[model samples]
Structures are given as structure tokens and as C-alpha cells.
Target chain A: MESAIDTHLTACPRTISRRVPDAYQPPFPMFVGRADETLHQVTMAYLGVQYRDGGQRTAALAAVAEIVGTFDIADGPAHNDITRHTDKEGYVNLIVVGYWRDPAAFCRWLRSPDVNGWWDSPERLSGELGYFREIVSPRAEQFETLYAFTDNLPGVGAVMDDISGEINEHAYWGSMRERFPLSQTDWMESSGELVVVTGNPADGGRVVVQGHDNIALIRSGQDWREAGPEERALYLEEIQPTLQAGMDFLRDNGETVGCYSNRLVQNIDLDGNLLDETYNIGHWRSLEKLERWAESHPTHLRIFTTFFKVVADLDKLRLYHEVSVSDGANQIFEYLNCHPSTGMMRDAKVMASR
Target chain B: MESAIDTHLTACPRTISRRVPDAYQPPFPMFVGRADETLHQVTMAYLGVQYRDGGQRTAALAAVAEIVGTFDIADGPAHNDITRHTDKEGYVNLIVVGYWRDPAAFCRWLRSPDVNGWWDSPERLSGELGYFREIVSPRAEQFETLYAFTDNLPGVGAVMDDISGEINEHAYWGSMRERFPLSQTDWMESSGELVVVTGNPADGGRVVVQGHDNIALIRSGQDWREAGPEERALYLEEIQPTLQAGMDFLRDNGETVGCYSNRLVQNIDLDGNLLDETYNIGHWRSLEKLERWAESHPTHLRIFTTFFKVVADLDKLRLYHEVSVSDGANQIFEYLNCHPSTGMMRDAKVMASR
Candidate 1:
């Protein structure tokens, strides 16, 4: 039965998996046999310009802020896995990550007119720019993922249910493989397994995985004091459904055995901004298993397709994946212990100081 | 007799001479030697300090201007190598090059009361100051030399006269060797033969030598309209002498060789502020030669000893060195037809435009 679906899916060139091990199987029972599914990882980069002149610098910053404000998640079926950072005094770098069913569906989003319009915006001008360079190589060469820890668990039907619900509602990833097939292969071949572990390591915690290039911890900020009541309510209501949808997709198509997941709150900075706010980090038995889930799973496909459509017009919101190899711990202890400086955290800290 | 001199000079750490294959002794007994007799390269970084409340930037700029104004040949010896560039809004970056007997000699002048007092002077003080950070590294890597193209047909009498004159006026080599024996060996070993060519490749025009890692050019800037009469006179009378001294030192030391020297220049800003400036970039036939010079020379010893004495009291000065390798043609094209850029070239162009 599983072989039958695999044959059927092979008809779609965009949905074809690069190399799937014969022993591959899904963690959960689904409509299609686990043997039939394919998975792919995708990464994208969004560069923000910073001009040398003060006036132009101001203009660039404003444009970036405006773009970030327009990020939406309801426009398509794509799933979003993204992170953003800025050099205190220089440029802004954004990385977006997610999975896809195949390359064909991914290509449709790249050629979209919405993305082109943002690049051609009138306000995107630099003053006396000295260095303006861009680089795009396979994430495998650029970075490595050595460590990952999370609290969510596989077989928790609730999480998988949420993921499927979100995908069905948004219909995001179905067409991406045909549109951006190359991107899917590039990401899958380059990225490593996403490791998910249990517990908060910061509050007298320990990491389950020993060697990883990057570690993303997932947690909820329900206890965070800086968030106003209204803000907290709005976040829980809006994000829960989306997050549930993601969980549902993973439960149905993800592989089990040697897999892990974790849930944690976001890290915050001194300025009340989100530091590292990844929704969840999951560890697969191998990259091969992750690829399978991404390729043939309908729920996973819908999540990603919707994500790209929502932020397609926003220049600041980028989607990319990085595959890094970490020889030793690159992150400092101080960075790991601190919450990002959000208003809730700042207020709580102030109260404690007093 | 020539063999005897070669034997003696070869043994003398301070003296370097290359034997002519067939001594058809021209008008002067021409014995080629290495240039940059000072045998030391010094690098200094100037940092401007500004206040926390935006006053620091202006203060830093002013301090930069003040430092640039104090450049002079008598302070030590300059090699006509200086670079000054500014951004679009006319902020400045100034680098001055010159040669010194050693770091001690350079530092004493740098930290002298006269130089330090300028920082406190009411007219110059902005309550914002700039400082120097010194870095001294013996050149032990990335050094090479290629010597060619010289006037070989000069009468033996003329050559002898030139050699004798050099010996009489700058016979400091003997005592210098006595004081610092190790400094002399590296140069003696690396010094190449003095070849007399048929024509002056660098005569009446500019000779531009550019390589993968190095660039050296000598030209007449008589027509460049970048400076006023005072600046022009200063360039001709004051700057020219120092430049000539360097050229003569190179000619006497070896037929043609490369050595590090100091960079010196008058720091003039777009706002027309003048700065007192002094720094060094020692050169040698090779990195080994530089290292030997640093370890052995007595003049260098005395110079460095003096430098540390005043360093404790100085407001600022810095020194460091970087070694680089080259592969492509190191020597660029020689322009025999054109005159160097003097202040007059701009005026001629402007008049023509009118």
C-alpha cells in the first residue's frame, strides 16, 4: 500500500524526493502510507540595506520597520520557520526556514509579483554605500546545526492536530514544490536533523543532545509579566490555532524512533525585543526522515505555502535555512540564561530590582 | 682592493654592498648597498575620543586634525609616503609614513612635552582628545625585493665621489654596527647585485610599480593643483629633501631593493584643519633582514629605549606591522612621458575647461 502512494506521487516531478532510504516510515498512521512521503527543507535570505549617510540611514531603518510590520501568516498554506537579527550599528539580517512537499510548489512563491514589488519600492535607496554585497550558497557550506533541544513530544495528538488544522485552513504548501523545486533540494541536502529535547535548561536544566550545530528551545511566555492582558490574550488566540495546525501536520507525517520535540518560551533581549523565538525544535531520526515528511505530506505542504503567501509582500520577512557544524559551543552562557528584553520581562525585572 | 672592501663590508653588519661582476669602475667607484639605513619599521594607530553626549565625535575629529599638523622631516626622517582619504561627507582617514633609527627615537619625539602639551593647549583642546596606540612587530614574514634599472654609465670618478660623499657624511654605519651587530647581518645576506642599466626608467616621468601585494611609484607632481603656494613650497623644499634622502639611501644600500620606511604627511582636512603627524613603516630586503636589524642594531636599541621612556607620559601613539605575499607582476607600468601631479595640473585643466 505504501509503495502504491510512492508511485503515484512520483508522477509529480516537483514532488520527487532526492534520495529516500528504503526503510523510511512515518511516525504515525496517515491517509497515505509512510513509505510514500518525501520531505525537503528550504532556506532563504533577506538583506536590509544601511546607507553611510545619516539621512539615508534613517530612511533605510524606517523602510525595514515598515516591511516587518506587514508580515502576515494567513495569506497562504506555507509554514513559517524564521529568525531575525541586526548588527547593533550596521545591517539587518533575516533567516527564514521551513519544509516543502517538493521544489515545484516552492518555485511559485519565488516568482510572485508581491516579492518583486517590495524590492522595487521607492524608499529603498542608499546614500554613499561602501559595501553592498550578497552571498547565497548551499547552507551546508555556510553553517552547521550541531545541537537542538525542545520540550514537545511526538505522538502528542494535540500538537499534530493543530498543525493539520492550520494547513487545512491556510492551504500554503501544495503548489510550492512545482514552483521552487531547486530550493527544496538545496535545503534538504544541506540541512541536518532538527533535534528536540525536553525541559528548560536555563533554570537548572540539562541538554539531552550532546553535539549539535544549533539548538532551538521552544517554550510559552504565559508567565511573562511584560505582556499586557489584551496582548497575551490576542497572542494565545491567534498563534495557538496556527501552531496547532503545525503540530497536526508533523504528527501525521513525521517519522518516529530516535525523534524528539520540545516546547519553550522565547528568549528576550535588553530592549524588550524577542531574541530567539522559534515555535518548536524537533529532532528526526535522520535528515532522510525529515525529508520524507516535507515531500509527500499534505499538511506540511499547506503550512509552508500559506506562510510564503502571507509575508510575500514584506521585504523584511525573509525565509532561509542554515546548516552549520559546531565543533564547540558558539553561544555564551549569559546569552542562554537571559530572556529577550520584552516589555513584560523589563517590567518584571524592574519590579524585582525595586 | 675591491675584494678587500667586499670582505670587510660583508662582515660589517651595518654596511651592505654588492660586488660588480667586472669592475670597469665608472667615474665613481659605484658599490650598491641597501637603502632605509634606519633599519626599523614602526606603525602607530591614532584614536580620537569623544564625549558620551555626542561631543566625543567632534573632539575626536579635532584631535585628528591637531595630530596631522605636527609632521616634519627633522623630527626624524620621512619617506614621502602618506595617504589621506575621506568619506562622502568629508570625514578623514590619514596615514603618515616615515623611517626612524628605532622605536625609542620615534617614541621620545612622539611623547615629548612639546607634542603632549598641544593636547592641553586651550586653543587646540576641545575637551575631546585623540590618542595614539603603538604596536611594534619585527618583520619576520612577507618581505621581498627586485632591483633593476639604474644609470650604469656614470664616470668612475662620479661614482667614487658619490660613494665617498656618502661615507663621509653618513659614516654612522660603523658606530651603528658597533652598537647593534645583529641588525646588520640580515641586510648584508639579502642585498642583491647593483645592476647599471642603459637608461633611467623612472627619469623625467613617473614609474609606477604595482603588484599583487605592493605598490611603489615615483613621479613629478609639479603640475597638480591640489595645494596652495605655501603647500607647494613646503612640498618642494621640505618634503622633497626627505624624499630624496630616502631615494639616496635606497640607491646607496643596494642597486635596487625594497625596504619598509615611515609614512609622514601634513594632515589637512576638508574643513581645512591641520594636524601634527608622525609614524613609521620600516622596510627591508626580506622579513629575515628586518628581524635581524631589529635584534642587532645599536641605533635601534637606543631609539626603542627612548621610545618607551616617553610612552608612559604621552597622550597617544600606536605601532604595528602586517606581512603580505604577492604573485603577479609586482612592478607596474613606467610612464616616461608624463610629469607627476603637482598643484599646477588642476589649474591647467580648469583653465582648459574655461
Candidate 2:
């Protein structure tokens, strides 16, 4: 009952009229897109680790590979990237991300009865490393994905079962949260403005965030291919400064954006090797506050205007950004370890009775 | 209606009263003592920060003081401490912890007409600071508190409103979750064992966690009075090594005790000055696994037996410990500023979308 072309689509991040690789058994058929409209929930999972030892890194990598190798349910697809770095006083980490088109399939896989027993069992983790896993099931429009430059899908986009055919749409078709189907709160209109731009933080202040109604933005971009000198200069002279200034503003003046926490991370592979891809994760008390920082904050406006020019003029880079707006409730953070930067900890009610 | 003996509980870290503070005011008379025996909900709040600049820190500190000053009610009490610390990778943090014996009163204050007008206003946060506030309203037995040696209640104890009069009990009178009213999953009988003698980790291996149902133990103790040379030696030679080994074991080998994360924290003041108090926090898959490590893990058993001996023989040390147990469902974490040592963020679902 199935078309032969569907065979090639199995385990493929992208499905064009292209030939398929001879040998690729995905950890799971994460997103075969065989489901109908009855599906309402989709879940994504990310598991990552940073090996502390040069030798253990290999063992840990192999352990992850083994787990993936044994994983046969591709109700979705996954992405592997070299990310994260740290120092002596801190730590470095590597991460693996998985996406599922249907929440039921994810639940089925998670509760796969007896399958993937190692994962559900405590034995999957070894004493020699640090690891983390995140799971989220977002309803329609609750989560969105976009890709540019290449014809291929990556990260969460790959795991989407396209019964909805939404993946092929242009990445820039919508603005912020409106890019998805629902979440119409402020989609028709935008809020926030840039206040001022001074010198670098060590010299003077740059941007500030105020208000509790906030929005958080996360973005990752890297040179997909070789860039011309103009592209290089554009990034160096324009992009880098904006990013650094925004980050400095957050660190030096945490309250300016109603920003609670901000982190800029360098990506890494299982080998503990660094990559060009980076992620900026931050929490603002509200969307209006964050928009104000981006719109009027001289520092952010400059970056956005300049960066838009790059997007208009260039094709050598692939970029993606996501915005998740929260009213500050309906979310919980557990502190396995507490520190100066623990999330939502100021609001924590119970301490782990150790 | 007021008692003549009512007096102010000053900056005293430890105050035993034949009396209560006079000038002190809490945001609410959170524990009105009128709630029925059926009433079980209890809440606690902690607000903490790390000042960046001398000026900003001063301003931020002043802002907090003003807020607390205007609170003007205390059916239940609260404790304010200058406790927190920082490092090169971490910014300084100042914390104030409060307890509420009655959730209704706290809610009434939070929702009171013009009662807490200043707190609800978004404009209150100027965006030039780093601040966090945690609000927890756990059901009865969902939370518990204890005190020993010290005269005045601290942290969660201060806000209890004293109807139960449990704060005056010995710190070690109850086991695990039973310290409170109703959490009795496995409390009547104890689990785990304590063995003697151990190799030191510095030379080689000492203790390790190997089971899945283990429970984690966290405690902090500081000498109330000056410790003699013998006391120092007991800490340095006997206690310190064992505690360090247990922590190192968890950090270096995450799964050994069915443990995922463990942190040893030293307390500091508002100015980022150090205090003798400290805290240990950890996450374990189950209580059985944590118990195995505590009773039999070479590193912990040695430390425990010796530490217990000290508890029996000495009164110079004021000690306390707490542990919280959870499943993947009830807990969620958001990563803002990331480091290698951040929480088990692999399970993190939402990163800020910019």
C-alpha cells in the first residue's frame, strides 16, 4: 500500500528526488510521517555529555553510539553536534538531540515495553561521565522549526512526520512565535524597543531590559560553506560586536532585559572537538521586555539591521532562531546541583533532603 | 492584643528567645494558625542575588531591604541572611530565605488589594541587576524542617509559625521524609549501613556508589565555638577526606551511587564574604541506591561512622541535612547561563528563543 519512494524517505533527514545512501540504519525511524491527522502531541529529546577524560571520552562516545545503534524506533530523527566548552573551575559537555513527530510514538518508544531496555534501566549510565537528557511534548504551534541554505533538514525539523507538509515552507515566512500555527497572543503585532547604545561594557553601558512580561530567544548559526571576504568582514565588523555587547549587557547588568540568566555556548562533537556552531540561551521575565531590548536597544537594532543585510545578500551561511514566550508559570526547574546560576531556584520551595 | 515582651530579632544569626522580634514584619501573617487540621499546604520563599558592582550591589541591596521593610506582617516569621558566594566563572549571590506556615495567608498577601502593590508591579525591576525569587507551596509532609543546638530558627524554620513546636526537637530525631508530619514511604525502619576503615582517594580509590536504589545524604556543620587542635585534626584528617571522596566519586563517576549530580557549597554574606555554613545537594534515581552508597560505599561509611562519633561526643558543631526525592515528571529545569556543571539540562525542553 505504500509507494516505493517512501522507502528512501526512511531515516532520511531530507527527502528530495535524490538517491539514498547504501547503509544507514538510524537509531530509530524517528519520523516516517506515516501518521494521520489524529495526532496532537509531538515530543523531542536531547541527551548530551562531555567526557572528562581523553580516554573515557571514547568509551562514552561508544556507549552513546551503542545506545543509538540499538535504537530501532525512528518515529523521529535526530541531530548530533559538537557543542559546549568549559574550564578548570567549570565543565565542558557534548549533546545529542532527537525529535519525534508524534507524542504517542515517543511514549511508545519510551515505554517500548521491553525494547531499549538499557535506556529505561539505570545501567545505561556509567560512573565515568556526565550526561543529561531533556524531553518536551509540544502541541501544535507549540513548537516550530525552520531551515535555510541547504535542501536538507536538520535538528528537530528532520524528525517531523510531514503529514502536515509544513517542513518545506520557507524559514522566514513568519515572525517569532507566529511562525507556527497557533500562539496568536502578540503575533499580529510586536513589542519592545531599543533604548540606547554606548561603548563596550568595560567602557560604558550598552543595552538594558526592564519589565516582567518577557520573551526568550535562542539562535544558532554557522558558515555552512566557504564565505567570501565580504561575508567575513560583515560578521567580524557587524555581527560579532552586536552579540558580544548583548551578552556583556546581560552579564554586567542582569536586570536590564528583565533577564534572569544568559548563556552563550560553543558547540562540540563526541570527540570533545569544538565546532563553529554556537547557542545563546537566555530567560527574560517577559516578551515585551525582550522586544524592547531588540527593537530599540541601539546595540541589538544595529545587529539585527546588519544581520538582515547579510541574510539578503549572502547564501553561504545557515541560520535558525526560535522564540518561546512564557508567562513564567507552567514551567518547573529541578536543581540536581545548585550554584549561583541555578535556574528558577530563587522560587524553589523544597530542598532535596540529602 | 499585642504582648509587651514582643521585641526585635536583630542581625543575630542565632537568637534564642524567651521572646519574639518586635520591629520585624513579614509580607504576610502567612501562618494565621486559623487554618483547619485539614489544611496541609505550606509555602516557602527564597530571594537571592549576587551584586556585580559596588554601586549596583549597594542599590540592589537597598532595594531588597526596602521591600522587606515594607512587608509589615508576619503571622509566620522569616530569616534574612547575607549568605552566598562566587568565583571567576560565577558571579556573587546574596540570599534571603522565608517560610510560611499558612499558604492562604501568603496567597492573601500576594493577592491582597493594595497589600502587595509594589511586588506585583513589573516596573519595579529596573533591568540593571541580577535577581531571583523562588516560591514553593508544598502540601504537608511534602516539606519538613528541624533545628539543633542553635537558639533561633533559620531558613525554612523561621517561617513555621511554631504551632507544631517541632523546631525545638533534636535535629536527628526523625529519619528522611518522616521529619515532617506525613511522608512515611520507608521511614519507620532505616536503610543502609556504615562500615569502618577506607583507603584515601588522593592515593587511589576509596568509596564508590554501585546500586540503583541508593539515597543521597546532604548536611552542613560548622563549629559554633572555636575548635581545638584535636577538633581541627578530626575534620581535616578524618571528616574532610571522607566528604571529599564522596563528592569526588559522584562528580567523577556520576552513576556510582545512582547519583547524577552532587554539589558542596560554602555559604557567603551579602558582600560575598565567606561564612562557616555550607550545603550539599544531590540527585539520585532512587532512595535505595543512595542508601547503598551511604551504608556501604567505602568513602561514605568511614566518614559517617566517624562523624556520628563526633555528634555523640561533641556539642561545638551545629548541624543540619535535607534531601528531596523526585521523578522525571514532577521536575523541569531551564538553562539560562550554562557551564559544564549546570543541572541535568539534557532534559531541558525550552531554551530562550531570540
Candidate 1: give the TM-score of chain A. Answer: 0.28
lDDT of 2 at A333: 26
Go through the candidates in order and give each one's DockQ: 0.00, 0.01
| lDDT score for candidate 2 against the true structure | 0.42
Model 1: how far residue B226 lies from native, Å: 13
TM-score of chain B of each: 0.28, 0.54
Q: After superposing candidate 2 on the true structure, give the runs of residues whose Cα lies further than 4 Å from its correct spot.
A: A1-39, A50-56, A59-82, A87-89, A113-128, A144-150, A160-174, A185-217, A226-229, A244-263, A267-270, A282-289, A296-299, A325-354, B1-354
Off by over 4 Å in 1: A1-149, A153-354, B1-41, B45-69, B75-105, B111-354
